[model samples]
Target: MDKQPLLRNLETNQPCQPLSPQLLSMAATAAYPGAPQAEELASAPPAHLFDNVTGYEGTTAGGEERFVPPPLSTAEGAGRHEPHPQGAWSIPSITEETAREAFIEYASSKCCYSAKPAKEMVFRDLKSCNTYRYRLESFTESRSTEWTSEPYKGQFVDSSAYGPAPLPWSIIVEIPQLFQDNIEKVPVPHTSSIKGCHSCMAMGRRACTNCTATGRVKCQFCNGRGYKFDDRCNRCHGIGLQCCIQCNGSGTIPCETCDQSGQLMIYIQLTVKWKNNVLESVADQQSGLSADLYEKMIGQNIFTDEQVRVSPIVTFPEIQINQASRKAIQEHQVQLTRTSLVIQQRQTIEFIPITQVYYEWKGKEYNYFVCGVDNKVHAPDYPAKCCCTILCAVPGDLPMASGGQTVPPANMLDKLAGYESIAADGEERYLPPPVYPAYNAEGGQPQSNQQWSIPSISEDTARQALIQYASEHVTYSSRPAEEMVFKELKPYNMYRYRLQSFTESRSPEWKSEPYVGQVIDSSGFGIPPPPWEVPVDIPKMFEKNKKKVQVPNTASVKGCHKCMAMGKIPCNDCLQTGRVKCRMCDGRGSMLGNDTRCNHCMGNGVESCRSCSGHGQQKCDVCQGRGQLYFYIQLTVKWENNKFEQVIEQQCEFPTQKLSKVTGKELFSDQQFQVYPILGFPDPRINQISQQGIQEHWTQFGKTSRIIQQRHTVEIIPVTEVQFQWKNKEHSYFVYGTENKVYAPEYPGKKCMIL
Candidate 1:
């Protein structure tokens, strides 16, 4: 059955490489390959269950290219030519249960030296010496016209020159120590290691979004005001001036309340966040570029051709955090004496696994090694078919013919065509020459805003298309018909309807009233009306004048003509009806030193009815309750220079007050910082140290034993391999690619071995 095509790579025209079964299982389970720690389980040999383990436990290495799949092709004929699968180096798959069992068993394996429990095996720092004593060998003088870098006694400047001298390469080797059998039996000394760091909490640096690197932003609310204004005044129409509605007079209206202070209460709230991470170190070296040190400079092609081919001895160490002390840790030291090594010429380049040797310098551990820095620069797309070699003078060796090929340029790009073709997408077209107007018979053209060549009208189809295009392009044009617009139609219709309502036509009789009322000047019979009104007594006289008569004391009722003629009431205090507000009581009932009635009640034999006081009636406080002092008022106030004297029908109020204050800095400090851990190994401390393998035999005094051999050389090369493992009776596999393939041992079984 045809399988679905793997995800297409964006650049290369290939399906994404399938994940190895091991990786697929890992992805599904979210588990990672961690170093085994159990000692007892690992010490149990797998040979007991499976006599022959065909697979080797080692790291694979190779170079890889990034792949990006091309877009899907539609040509039916091309489908027939699908390429067969080309598998690459990959990891083997294993079930979780199998991997777990394997890890535990591996961790429990006995130490390689003593065959003792691995769990009980402890790591100890090895002391190293930088000084060395060596007898001078016959130095060979080597020369080349081209200059190369060398150590100097003078300060180095760009113009510094290379001094003539015998080939000055030096090499040193660690005299691998052979520990006595009793060494394993002896207990390791108590480490008592201690480390110190600044005790203060780390300060985080937070980004300022508001100021955008300046650490500040403008206040959006209140425009940065500490407070805001809300209430608008109600009196004088908010203009601080009033005009009378009755006579259009400009004066203060006598307030029935506090006589017009014209003030109103207003209220406002603010919010803010704290800028806590202002000076904190929220992140560190994680932001810096990272890679495995040994994996990078040593295993990877980080070295230049001169640094590699001339084969400079690399001295970087594998340093890790000491689990015991939380301080840096190192194993042993390695020194390469110039006389002890050689740089062999090779026709092809390869990857070499980094040997786990330790060194020490300044009381720290470092790992160092010597390897054939194969001519990486000399390799081509198909691997080097020809060889380029440079032979430096070697001590104690015959002065071999003093002739050899010169070193090639570091970047020999001429040999590689794959990278060049990949970069060429295609050539672009050039534009044609511009057309010039013909010089017609004595042609000198006149310029006009209106040109005769322009068409006055367009074809209907063309015109309709242009109109539609214009309507679409000019989004805000109101001339576009409603049917032409693409949005829902209701809001537009409502908007147009509202606009039409503003200019609606009016009817002629809309403002005219249907009925009217008039003012009368006369009261009942021949009585006078109010004093503010003109007297109508003459109009009611009917051509006859009645004799003027004095009102009897008993006829002193309100509105009585005789009593009014006597001028008994104060006009401001009374209703101009012959009655008066009693001076002794101020219009309230009961006068002092009298019968709570009229003054004459106790002395002149004139008594009040008491129920009505001496005036025969009481003023109502509840309607003032007797109805004596009652009056109605339609209250008016000037609001924004307009008179609003209408009696209030209803009123409501919303009460809110300013609760808190917010500053601009607080408002802009709401953002937070995120942090992540640093990747890669830190620098080492020492140049040389010693580490004795526990299971491996070590050299004893004066023993020519193969197991204890000292002088040996191994050629290193890089190779790619596929990875697989058995899980649940099934094989899982994966190929090494760009992200995974790194330098490993040349010997698949020995170098770079995991077990």
Candidate 2:
């Protein structure tokens, strides 16, 4: 019979491939750091060995059973109720003088208002209408299990070696105190088992995929052309191939699944999660005040109850409050009990008062509401009206005539002639309305019709603005902006279109290769679905995700191609000679001085090949020396959100890039699984771009990938370009977006280096 080839102990007869004593010691120590020595382990009793197992415990006296906590004792008088308060719950009303003062203060806050209406308007009546709010909290704890694994480092195995492993849920673990939100992970005792690594089949190494087991790979520097720009490539020295970096020219890598130890420790891990769930509701007062305003206010705590589970309040005067509590408790129990354990529940009731104030100005009537203990006001119509030109005037320093009455300057009186104001006697009065002229007060043609115009700032205000701006920017100098002549203020507005294409796509490719001990995934073994037909759940938009699955009916075994079924290949290093020319003597059989014998080769001129250890052949990496191959198809599912944005060109100096950092008022928004192009948008450019984007995405990605979802939106970004003059030079700044964010790129005072 032919001599059997060596497998695990290939280095036994070859000195060139001798195993290192230090390496073996380190590997053994790392595998079992606290394990007893081989002799001691062999002599130790079975019971002692089991006791030493990590995260393992002996079986309980009873069979597998879920552990349940003892029931909580019910508190006495848990459902008792208190009688509702008599009379309406309302705060004292404000006096007429106080209301008038509030209106005057509100008027003074505006830059353009004359404050005449506030000072003269008479109070008709004061109506007080008040509202109430309620809240509930539920705290819960939940438990779950999942399979987890780690490298087997001689850990105790309960299955097969010891006996059947303990059930996952039956494993005992310490439960944390309830009510507080927390999480804990515990490994189920006696559930761990040892399995041979499926990746490398206990060989501790795998063929390097990058080099295809040849110990060399194409040079990336020259794209494997051996030359770059008609010159010899320095990276690969014109050889076209370089030693594989991944395997360090060994053509093999340590198995990651087993951490190079060739075995895996598998166990079940239990996760205990604690959570606090809260629900709230409010009662409507029909006071015409916005319900949302009540959210910011705190109310009086009329009733309080704490128990394992509290009953809904039935004695409350408001039917809505009682019904809201009942609905909340029922909903929490139905939703949470399905997945988590309810630890404790607490509920409380609060009363927030809202009062609406009604007052009349001239002959017409208007009202303002005061809410909560802090007296927050919501007055959309405050009676006082003004023109946009007032934006340029200094706040709180309105132009005044004699007797404290606000009046326009003689120069502006002509401009205010066309506007009319209503007085307290229900008659028309001639009052100066704040006017923002296109030209300066000195009279000149407007700078740009495309630009928005605001009143020019006074020299003092300009100086203060420069000082504040310079303080914020470390590289700025305030001298230039402060010394320059104050000029005109111009504003510009721009719009942009943003299209987001969120797609979930699947691509299938035939992947046939030699198999080792990989577990066959037959989950997709039925009729394969078309790439586009595969149903996949949509994930969060704009998030990139990827997953792979084995294609159905595409797996098979075939003869190995690299070795031609021989399971071995001639060693490339020695070229099947089993020996290589001695490096010390250069294959001359003698060293320097002619007669000096080659000690390394003993004058033979050749040494055993280090790569194959003089065996003339190496195990085929393609089949892992198995002489067969496993062919299959792999499907890759990718979720990607492609965002395309285009800003319409503007006729102003505002930087388009600045709009990206700030959010604008969304003019139009649409989202769907697959969206149609937008139509009838106010801006024709927006409609055109929407159509172009949809078509381009379909043509580019739709052909190769399935489209999952798409969302597109248009926004009117408020861009106010303010142009001003300083020291006879013109400068501009931008006040953009609803937030009124300022962006001044070319401030007159910048680039000043501080020594």
Q: Candidate 2: where are CA atoms >4 Å away?
A: 1-475, 479-489, 519-526, 534-537, 677-684, 728-730, 737-746, 750-755
lDDT of 2: 0.60
Candidate 2 lDDT tens digits, 1-755: 23222223555653222233344444444665554333111211223222233323432211222333322334322554432333333333466676667666667777776687767765544544554577778887666655556688886765545555454445566556655678887866656666555455456785566665568767666766677787778877877777776687896788776778977676655666778888888887566655577778766566666666777877665678889989998999788776666767778777665555665454345677666654556678876776564335433332322212122122311111112121112122212212212212222211212232332334455456556666544346778656666456554556677777776665555444567766554325555444444455666777889876765545556566566667877676777778998999999888865565576897799999997899987887767688776655555677877776777767886656556556776666777655666655555787678777776776666655556677877777766655677767788776666655566767776542212
How well is each residue in 462-521 modelled by candidate 1, as lDDT tens digits?
A: 224334433322112213221222211110000000000000010110010111122222
CA lDDT of each candidate? 0.20, 0.60
What's each prediction's TM-score?
Answer: 0.09, 0.37
Q: Report the Cα lDDT for residue 613, model 2.
A: 90
Q: Model 1 TM-score?
A: 0.09
